[model samples]
Target: MSDFLIDEELLAAIDMGSNSFHLAIARLDHGEVKKVVSMSEKVQLAAGLDDNNNLTDVAQQRGLACLSRFVGRLSSVQANRLRIVATNALRQAKNGQDFIDKAAKILPKPIEIIAGREEARLIYLGVSHTMANGGRRLVIDIGGGSTEFIIGEQFEPIYTESLQMGCVAFTNKFFADGEINVKNFNKAVSAATKELLAIANVYKEEGWETVVGSSGTIKACRQIIINLGWSDEKQTITRTGVEKLKEKLLKYKHISELDFEGLKEDRRAVLPAGFAILYAIFNVMDIDRMMYSDGALREGVMYDLLGRFKHEDIRDRSVQALVGRYNIDIKQAERVVKTAQKLFDDVAESLKLTNEDSDLLRRAAYLHEIGLAISHGGYHRHGAYVLEHSDIPGFSQIDQNCLSHLVAHHRRKIKADLKNEVLKVGTPALVYLCLLLRLAVLLNHSRSDQMLPAIELTVLNEQQWCLTVSGDAKQWPLLVADLHDEQAQFKHWNIDLIIQSEKFID
Candidate 1:
């Protein structure tokens, strides 16, 4: 038991939400997360959006300050054990990269701004973990700028949707003056219902056995319902409770004077608007009652990080799914992957590369010919375009760019313009990796199991690389021709590629 528990190490997650920032530290006990500590601050980063949809300077400063404090407490956690995620606020910000750069300087880990559907998937994971044994569960999370709806069985999400309606954003639009009335409340709820209408039909048809809510808004709403005596002691927010809360909230006519039994001071400003959104969701989606879940996106991030270490990486699954969807050639991909790995191992130490670099080489090799599915002519460009533009799950924009560069130049004539662009973003390491990938693809061009000669790669200096092939090189004339062609490409990048055979040795 002690040995098993030792493997279940401590994990931490930071959720930089639109409305708030949260940090959670947990320990895995019997496959369940036991919360050790947690912290949250009302950042309202989404509400700081300027007219151009960029995060305001004040908002960026506030976010950075909060992350600095969060980083202080995360001193014990390793970079790999900690996961940071940004939500709708960063997603909407045109200057998101600016803020990300500032935050990365202060935080212990890099932040991943997940896509909306991915957000829905993680929300369901968090909700499902906290819920009791049940059939299909419908999970809804109303954030400051977006709301996520998901239906899942056990731990796997089946349906996920994200709608652009939330507490803070709605408040700014409908109740920014702090005045709340029946007409304004109705307008807000109507707007929320309109957004839900897009997915309501599909979710209804799919159906669910239970409904669960997560995040600050839902937690606050549940408390209000229980304190107002509208629901039972079990803490479930019922439809009747939501309706009554709306009626009571409308009586105030202003957010400042709005006093509710369970409303916290921090929640007072967004309460009316959040309640309106919840009311619309319940009415539109026909939710009878929703049990609250303590687990949310941050918990899901930690769990996902754990999975990566345990070899259940979603990125691997996503890559396989892409291959299956594109109908890529499995045998050819395996051949390329094998050849790339073999070359990578030979020069990796001399190249000063990490395991991650090796992994990147393998993935690029596997998907190199994916563009051939589009067209045989200039498929490398097509593949690069797809990778750069496609919404590949589990891949960041930077990750996609790196993969795109590798695939785009794998077999092409490396032009002067392409060399400059590659040099701008990557170090010598990337250049070497790209060279290895190109050589591997060239070697496997025949795509047959004829087994070529054992090749050795040596880095002579920053400006040159050498490949020595030993075996019956004369038997494969095409292989020899490809190597000669690759030499021209090496010249374009200011590197020399030398192919040595027994003839050269003699």
Candidate 2:
């Protein structure tokens, strides 16, 4: 029923959620994301996690099969215009990379695993766009592997968290036998409440003016409650409605026995666990009522992609935030950023680099000194840790991981083992980017307004680079020595750095 040919200006996002895989291909109409075609399949990937936390082969097959189906739907979309993101299930899986590798074979783009807080941030992004300027709001999305809680104004999230509580996970944990009894139900509720303990006080203190729920679980609950006449149509999910739903759910002998008016067939099994988690949230957060939002993570990913196309990227904001929070030397950072940009521009076409790669180098330049906020010693390692662990709003886990490596090796003695790891991800020219940042940093070591000598960088091959130093060659002794010394470090990563200069080196 949907045609991409009708709309060339389209953005596509695939949400590889724990319980489902969703695809939304949308085009911008009047500055709003309008879905040309949206599809969701109940892959239930969380149910495939073994006791060892490895994604089982069957589960991977299920996910891959779903993606293969989605590939047909995505035929009209360019690979560059699409984003694929996996949430908590894959995040918790030991063999997540294994799954992603297989998925990479069929999907338009490689799947990106987002951190929990980043997940919360995107979920809030989607919800905020759909709301009608509704004051401060608390948005909750319960997936199969985790639950996201976000409190934000219209577009800015004040607090965000992805708690380890979800329908599929809880069903396996608390309702394994599928016994529809009050004891099992209460156990799930209590477990959810315990999970919320750390975040409850913060959400309450930061307090939202209204509460909104999103994703399949909440949508199913709202539908069942409103259809059953437990809650009026005006109140999709109220405390009273949830309590009544729980009472009715307990009346069933087993999960398969659930037969509510508006309950979908697929949601029947996970309903009890989802309801329990929602009930716990209601009790812990003291919520009297909640509204449902149609927007969610996939929608959020689409909007984020659209923003990047519009040059209103949130990752830029994140990098600026890091610079300010860590009190990075702004002038020094600017120098490195400018030099890095120039170097990247010089070697970009030769190395098949992209705008995304350029952006990565620029962001890493800005946050290179982020670790100085902690301590001057091994600040590079500190910055890497922060980038890897911190909730950078618009960055995927892979991007953070790449930036971490770039920052980690920017000024260090690139360890042999780490060098191998860096080389393993050579597609984005990460090693070359590291080398460029190092050169940029080295060239700006003086940290003064005095302009450094004009230098041009060119790639000789995958493993070789050439730097041509021009301008006043007399002021190049210390810089020449620094560049000479950095060459050995560059060689450590199996990259050859050839320096061309006149009358400066001994």
Candidate 3:
């Protein structure tokens, strides 16, 4: 295969979980993602955290080494075709960015640390793709660092949440000494129960006809129950089997003494804690049984990447949803988006802007007035906060921040500190996108059905640019004054902005 494929193309997604790191490779087979390869390493990244939640050097080394091996498997994968995402362990680490900095030298692409809710969304997507047309399924995935609960139908999730309790984290809290007594086991269950309590009622209200368990912990439990002859139904986990396993589990005082058929040696250490969490879920939500799905986070990611390449991006849906929810002026938004896109096309090559940056500019233009829904005073700041905090389905945390910065400075004086935040995205394109959005909004200040005259943007050089408004200058007094007023802002931005009308000269 070539570096990039037009058909039957290979797409990849890596899930850097708290307990294990996984890489899944697939190819687009008639608009569906078919698996090519699946690989995972038990790096125990969550266990590597010190008391202060800093990832230890030893843990970082373990993760880096594993990633090095993964890179060997990805030699044929194109950089743009791969997506790497980190879950709760990285999110909780104090020096997560420090670790990401070092890993950037090794991986094919930069790592995206996703928010908790976003993680749940992807997990649901993965489970939905591999399963049958089971209506209203509740999926629960137990990982090393955190557990995700999602109630979704088909590919869309109805409710998604990530709880802080996970198998590895619980093991550290209640089973650190390797002992698994009734006291400690119940305590672990109780703690997990407490974590689920907050969301139990809402999930219960939004009931599901079927339940699914995914990832390492639940998979191991299903296997162990079958191996121990506790469940006659080999593929399913039953309530009776769980009770039998619980009775037998408490009989052993330590994890080392407990052995069941089909249990992997690697999962031995965390199995007890994993069982406790599952037990809590079974009781709290009154679940009868849950079918296990082999697919999870990584699979969902590949399918999502497939959507982006096909131009059916969920981010577009998210933006449109906000527009409808806020009752935004659709006509006005369309005007700004059209002008912003033209501006981007004019200066894209000179500024080294990519299609992604152009997309950001369009989305920002449409959402610039989102804050007016809350309050007219400092609405830009309010809009920024909304973007930063809203759980838009497909946006990564950094994606939200980038959009937030653009919306925040659309009309007001651009803050100096914003440059630093923009740089964290590993791009200077945001600086240019911010300018394009600002000018687009300024051009559409009239918010009239009558279209404005033809506007042209030219890049004189790297540090200089000119906006030439065509047609009669006398008719555009408000826009003319706005352009002149923006001159001082340009003076401090290291760019010489020349704004004038074709009918006149500056």
Candidate 4:
């Protein structure tokens, strides 16, 4: 069995945001998360993004420096128990891979760049966990490069959306000179309004009992209003308070000149842009008041990690939803899954595959035939498209892409180009998993529940492997022929796949 350990005593989550990087360390106590440590730094990674959407060297350096500090505190955390998630900046950066490679050297774990909707889901999760449980609530988080809005009840999010409007991004777009004039502020508001147009009607129609705001921008804004005495005793962000703040912002020609009691020096640069987005949200969605929530993406990730260890993985539900959506052949999927599990178990330790790898393989096996629902011809490609494009809540874009590659190449001719593509993300290990999946699918070609020969796999090295089946050679000529084809396929990837029967080896 593959050896992987989770630090049940402590869990850590890192949020590599566009504007800042935050780390939260916590321990689960009596079914509750007790935070032990927290750290944050304003890296402003998004502000360094160029016209081509590539992270500048300066931004990469800042991110690496911050993560290096975070690494120091993670010495005691288990690799499997910590999750580092990146938001819009990394998602938009063309040089994200280079940055990630640099960060890998300093971090205990690899960085996972989540999709927009997934970020929204996590933000909602964080907010829900911290806030009182009940009623449908609207949660908004304005990050450095993107903004996420979620509508959820208790611990479940009913709707989530992420828009390409954020403090740093909007500041760069409309307030680059640090000017806070009426015309520029109105322009920023208009830009933000346009971004919100797509979801305004739907959010308003669904309605929410409470309006909540998360992230630094919203928190800072709420504090500024409270300090200015614009808000009443409740410390709620009201529509009039926002208007008053906007009026004060309009009076200042430059952001540097605007000095409020609660606004910090670093936040002044992006305050106008953030406020414009908030103003647009209020106007478009008709929000009367919004309460700030201390929870956010980092907290959500910690809880999510906790859930995974608890065997309440949301990804499993996501996979099941995909299965039901496509009307897949359940029996065939089970057959492939059973065989995949057996093969995985036999060589997991020898191949150095982790439980995560096994889970990915099993999920892929279950959904491999989903594309067949679309068309008999090129069904693999169809399935890949669906998996890649669909909004799977718990899976990251990388996870979706990984599944897509496996599904696309499961049955077809294994092309060198495809292998290279999978290598870019999956590495050689994932290719091994894919090969295992292919063998399982091949073994279950009949798609019947009939008992098959016991099969075993042995991994001698990176590029060599063997499979042994417990049966007579003459009884399964078709299976023998398929194994020979698989052997040739593996040969293209420079892997020697040896097939053996009870008495003979081929």
Q: Please tell me which predicted candidate would have the highest TM-score against the true structure.
A: 4
User: What C-alpha lDDT do the candidate models reach, one value each?
Assistant: 0.84, 0.88, 0.88, 0.89
1-506: candidate 1 lDDT, tens digit per residue: 01223345788999988999999988878767777889999999988998899989999999999999888888766666777888888989999989988886897766778778877777777777777777988889999999999988998888888999989899889999999888888899899989999999999999998888899999998988898788866779999898888777777967889677767788889988888999999999998898888889888877776666666767777778878888889899989999999999988888798776887888888888889889999999999898877766566555667788999989878886777787654556777788899999999889898877788888898788899998776677888888998999988888899888775332
TM-score of 4: 0.96
Q: The CA-based lDDT of model 3 is what?
A: 0.88
TM-score: which is higher, 1 or 3? 3
* Tens-place lDDT digits, model 4, residues 370-395: 88888999999999898889889889
**Candidate 4 Cα errors over 4 Å, as ranges:** 1-8, 503-506
The window of 10 residues in a row where model 3 has the poorest summed lDDT is 1-10
All models, RMSD in angstroms: 3.0, 2.8, 2.1, 1.9
Tens digit of per-residue lDDT, candidate 2, span 1-506:
12222334778999999999999998878778898898999999999999999989999999999999999998878887899999999999999989888887887677899999999999999999888967999999999999999999978889889999999999999888878888898899999999999899988988878899999999999988877887766766899998888778888989888888777888888999998999999999999999999999988998888778777889999899888888999999999999999999999999887777888899999988999999999999999999989888898889988899889988967765776687655454787788889888888899887977888998888789999888656676788778888888888777788988675454
Query: Predictions ranked by TM-score, top down?
Result: 4, 2, 3, 1
lDDT score of model 4?
Answer: 0.89
Candidate 4 — which pairs collide? none
Q: What is candidate 2's CA lDDT for residue 384?
A: 92
